[model samples]
Target: MSILITGATGLLGRAIYAQCQAQFPTLDIIGTGFSRAQAPLVQLDLNDAAAVRAFFAKYQPSVVIHAAAERKPDVCENDPEQTLALNVETSRLLAELCHEQQSRLFFISTDYVFDGKNAPYAENATPNPLNFYGKSKMMAEQAIVAINPSHTIIRVPVLYGEVEYLAESAVTVIAQQIQQNPQSSHDHWAVRYPTHVADVAQTIADLIALPAAQSAGIFHVSDSQAMTKYDMACVIAAALGQNASSLVAVPEPTQSAARPYNCALKDTRLKQLGIVHSRKFDVAIQQIITRS
Candidate 1:
């Protein structure tokens, strides 16, 4: 079987591509990035409809994992048109192509779709996005479902993992800040279940192995443990053998785009599939630090 992965140069996409190659050695895998001319990733801009159509025609992949998006909430809020073009329009195009090719499209979504009012959101939770980024993703999900009900949608929380670049993951960004200035402060209000990208990749592989009867619809791939940014910073500091005592806890600051206060997702469906093996927050953080 052939698989096509978009945003292959990104954190989660890269991890998914690597894990798929390692686990399914005989499978044909094609990765695409916007401008990256890397060996494994071809330069294909999803915004270009003609180019994307040509790519799908050439590859005719059995599975298409749509992982590219304008993820920054503030940036999306600032440029709603661009956000819609990149997040929603690209996804719609890919969904149409995948449907024509009879390929399973795995769209990577985010937990930000939930309104922070609820604690742990389930797969069936109603999405009330507070920011344009989340709204775009929700629209994409709806479009994909309308086009192809058998497609898979995986919603993940804040992700941190082994990155090609040091500052790619938010966890590593925090580590860099702590290293620069041990006396740093972080938001104590916003809560998130920071999941490892490797775990997300493994979940994708497992889903692929499952029968079509089992692997359709939305699945949450989040860590069970939820913590505040302050808590995450402390964990990073501790893992790096730095003094977290110097870190101060501050209230969540206002942003151009409002973020969910507690967008922790519950992986009930994934657990039901018997494929949920999320690593502990501390353990994952330590591993990332050690690897860095």
Candidate 2:
């Protein structure tokens, strides 16, 4: 079956597009992007209603993985309008279009949906987002289910893998900061599960392989290893053969936007399907660092 992947130029979307091609070589794979669109990747603005509809009509993809979004908490906080338009409005439009075309939509959501008070969140847990980014995704989730109950919502935690630049991902940005300034400080108050993008892409592919009825609704995909920004920085320091002691660990909230301490997503639904893929943070980060 043919597949459409939005935000193809993005970190996660790029990985998803490549992974899908590797897994399903014979199937049609169309990628959409804005700034970085190339020959194979179409330049389609998801915010434009007419363009999105026209493109969907032309491709008639059986499945659409909507991975495009404004994920930064601070950015979303700074410009709520843009965040709402890109994250929430875009999903609303895609949901409507996918339903009209009878194509299943797999929306990429964030673990930021929950407050830090809760430890491990189940699929059925109610979202109490601590940031605008998370709230937008939560609203988009509601819109998607309302527009098309058969659609899927895949919520993932902090992601890092195969970046075009270190700044592209929060996980890799730690390395970038340390490289630039060995005395850089990192937040130690928050705990995060940094899942590899490839694993999440593989999880999506496995879900797409299942029947629509079986894979519909919410699913959490994340690595089990927990680490704060300080923890990640230390790991990066070790990989660089630098002393981890040089990095300062700030124990209070530092960002402009409010952040949840820990949002550990429980993949009970995925466990039931017997589909899982994960890797150790230290080992994977080393490979990524070496590659860069």
**TM-scores, each model vs. reference:** 0.96, 0.99
lDDT of 2 by residue, 1-292 (tens): 7999999999999999999999889999999999899979999998898998899899999999999999999999999999999999999999998898889999999999999788899999999999899999999999999998889999999999999888999999899999999999999999999999999999999999899999899999988999999999999999988899999999999999899999999999999999999999999999998888
> Model 1: residues >4 Å from true position, as ranges?
none
What global local distance difference test value does model 1 have? 0.88
Question: Model 2's lDDT to the true fold?
Answer: 0.94
In the predicted model 2, the residue pairs found to clash are none
By summed lDDT, the worst window of 10 consecutive residues in model 1 runs over: 163-172
Q: After superposition, how far is residue 229 of candidate 2 from its true place, in Å?
A: 0.6
Specify the highest-TM-score model's number: 2
RMSD list, candidates in order: 1.3, 0.7
- Model 1 TM-score on a 0 to 1 scale: 0.96
Summed backbone clashes in each candidate are 0, 0
